[model samples]
Structures are given as structure tokens and as C-alpha cells.
Target: MKFQLDEPQGGNTIHRHDTRSVWVNGTEHRNSLLVPWQGTVEDWRLTRFEDLTEAHFERIRALKPELVIFGSGSRIRFARPQLYRALIEARIGMETMDIGAACRTYNVLASEGRAVLAALLIED
Candidate 1:
């Protein structure tokens, strides 16, 4: 679905998303990516939810977002606590959802000027 909103001047915002891809700032990205509310988008290099590791969570931790929206591809799959123990220890909040929901939530939080990160996994 396409999200109708004026793009914020600096921060990243999801403009559209379907099952296969997500559009950030009008650019379509088909692979996994990390979208920070106020930073450059980067490739997440995670193809599946199972690929998630402590190191991956650590990377998100380094961004220091107050909340994280984890898009577990096409469905809602919870990750083992051990995979993201660092986030729990750091007191950062994380919510897991399907990719589409994650996109929508990310847009809302970002528009509200919240420090949020959307770690979305898009299947090939």
C-alpha cells in the first residue's frame, strides 16, 4: 500500500510498502534495510528472521533508538530473547510485527518525531 504524506526534509519515512518491497522516501528497496527516524537508510543484510543474532541486535542498539519495530518478513514471528538480550538490557523497546504493519507503524512514529527504527526484512 502507498502512504500519502509529505516527506520529512531530513528523517527517513516509509512512503509505500507491499509484500515484496518497501519504498522509503520514494525509493523502492526489495531487500532488508534499517530505517532510522533521523538517519540514512542502510542495508540490514538479514534475509530471514532466523538470521537474526546478537550482533544484529547490537547494531540496532548502537543506533540508540528509543523503540524498534522489527518486521519479521511476511508474518509476525517473535525472536528468541537471547537474540536481542542487549536491547532488553539497554531498556530499549521493541515490537515485532508483519512487514506491512511495521511499515505503517514506522511512518506514524517517525511522523510524530519519535526516535524509532524499523528493521524490516523483505523476502526475495
Candidate 2:
């Protein structure tokens, strides 16, 4: 799906998002990735939802985002709290949603200048 931004400044804009890809700043990304409010996008070398571990959340925590919008691929599935114990310990909140919702939410929060990260999974 494509998104039109009302306020396009202050952070990265998610122009389009789908099951296998997302367009960030007009460039298409076809992999799981970490989208920060105003920083370089990082590729997340992950394939399966079941493979998520505390280490993944810890990586996000290291970036120091106040919150995370975790996209569980094509569906909305919650990871066990144990899998993200690092975020909890760091006081960094995470919200789980389907990939599409996560993309939209990330754009909104990012435009508002909130410290947010979208850990979107583009799984096969």
C-alpha cells in the first residue's frame, strides 16, 4: 500500500509498505529492517517469527528508541514477553501489530518527532 504524508519532514517517511517490501524515502527495501525515526535504516537478518530472541530486542534497545513498533510479518502475533525481556528491562515499550499497521504507525510517530523504531519483519 502507498501512503501520502501530510507532514513529511522531521524524520523518515514510509511511502509504501506491503508483505515483502517497504519504500523508505523513495527507495524500496525488500527485507526485514530496523527503521529509526531519523537515522540509517538497518537490515535485520531474521527470517522466522519463532526465531525471535532476547538478542533481537536487545539490539533495538541499544539504539535507545523510547518505543518500538514491532511488525510481526503478515499477521499480528505477539512475542512472548520473555523474548523481549531486554526491552522491558530498558523501559523501552514495544507494540506488536501486523506489518501494515506497524508501517503506518511508525510513519505517524516519526513525523511527530517521537523517538520510535519500527522493527518490521518482511518474511518469506
Candidate 3:
């Protein structure tokens, strides 16, 4: 499925997404990546939900987002709270969903000027 959103004036907004890839600001990303509401897009090393770890969540914590939208590949799978204890302890909110939903939600939140991050996991 593909998603479309009215482009935000600045910052990153997820423009489109399908099962195989997510397009951010008109650029397609097939690998796991970090899409901050207002920052550089970078490749995330995690490839699957199982690859998630405290270290990974710590990275998200370092980004200092008010909330995080975790795109767990093609389905909705909640991560163990311990895996993201850092974010929890920091009081950073997080929501888990399928990749497609995450993309849509990210776009909405970003367009509304929320400090959100989309940590998307793409199956290899």
C-alpha cells in the first residue's frame, strides 16, 4: 500500500510508504532507518524486530524526541519494556505499529509540529 501526505514546509515528512519501502521527502528508503521530524535521515542498523536492544532504544533516547513511533516491519509487535527502558526512564512516549501505519502516523504528527521519530524496521 502507498500513503500520501501534504508536504510540510520544512523538516522530514513521510511522503509515501509501501510494503517494501518508505519514501521520505520523496526519497525511497528500503533499509531500516531513523526519520526524525526535523533532522537528517540516517540508516538504522536494526533489520528486524528481534534485533532491537537497549542500545538501539538508547540511540532514540539520544535523539530527544517527545515521542517515538516504532515501525515493526510488516506487523504490529510490541517490544519488551526492558528493551527500551532508557526511553521509558526518560519519559519519552512510544507507540508500536506496522510499518505502514507508522509512516502515516509520523506524517500526521510531523505535520502538526510534534517532536516525533519514526524508527522503522525493514525486513531484509
Candidate 4:
């Protein structure tokens, strides 16, 4: 779906998203991604939920966003806390949702200038 905001966004904006792909800054990203508040979008590498590991969470933790929106693919799935122990220890908050919902939430928070990151998983 397409998204719109009244005012201009100073950071990266999620323009559209579906089950397979997400459009950010007019670029199509079919792979999982790390969409930060502002900066070049980074590829998250994992394709399926099972491919996720603690290293993935650590990658997001290293970014230091105040909150993380984890798009756990087409469905909502929670990662075991141990997988994200680094984030918890750092006091970074995270929320999990389906890819579509996560995309929408990320855009809203990003538009509002929140220090957020969208860790989207694209399933094959």
C-alpha cells in the first residue's frame, strides 16, 4: 500500500509495501532491510524467519535507535528474548508485527521524527 504524510519528512520514508517488497525513497527493496531514521538503508540479509539469529538483532542494536519495529515477515512472530539480549541490555525498545503493519508504523514514527528503525524480513 502507498503512504502519505502532510509535512515533509527529514529522514527516510517508507513509500509503499506489500508481502514481497517495500518501496523506500522510491527504491524497491525485495530483501530484508534496516531502515533507519536517516541514512542509507542497509540490507538485513535474512530471507525467512528461521534464518534470523542473534547477530541480526545485534546489528540493529548497534544502530542505537530508540525503538525498533521488527517486521517478522508476512506474519507476526516474536524472537526469543535471548536472541535480542544485546538490545535489552542496552535498553532499546522493540515491537514485532507483520511486515505490512510494521511498515506503516515505521513511516508514522519516522515522519514524526522519532529515532526509529524498521527491521523488515522479506520471506520467499
Across 1-124, the per-residue lDDT of candidate 4 in tens digits comes to 7586553456898889999999999999989999999888999999888877999999999899999999998889999999999999999999999999998999888888899999999888
Writing each residue's lDDT as its tens digit, candidate 2 over 1-124 gives 7586575565788889988899988899998899999878989888889888888888899999999999999999999999899899989999999999999999889887899999999998
Tell me the lDDT of candidate 4: 0.91
Worst 10 residues of 4 by lDDT: 1-10
Mind giving the per-residue lDDT tens digits that candidate 3 earns over 6-121? 66667898878877788898899989999999989988888777778899999999999999999998899999999999999999999999999999899889988899999999
Instruction: Please list the residue runs of candidate 1 whose C-alpha ends up more than 4 Å from where it truly belongs after superposition.
Output: 1-5
Weakest lDDT window of 10 consecutive positions for candidate 3: 1-10
TM-score of each: 0.91, 0.91, 0.92, 0.92
1-118, model 1: which lDDT tens digit per residue?
8775556558898988988889998899988999999978989988877778899999999999999999998899999999989999999999999999999999889988899999
After TM-score superposition, the amount by which residue 88's alpha carbon in candidate 4 deviates from its true location, in angstroms, is 0.4
Residue pairs clashing in model 2 are none
Task: Report lDDT (CA) for all predictions.
Answer: 0.90, 0.90, 0.90, 0.91
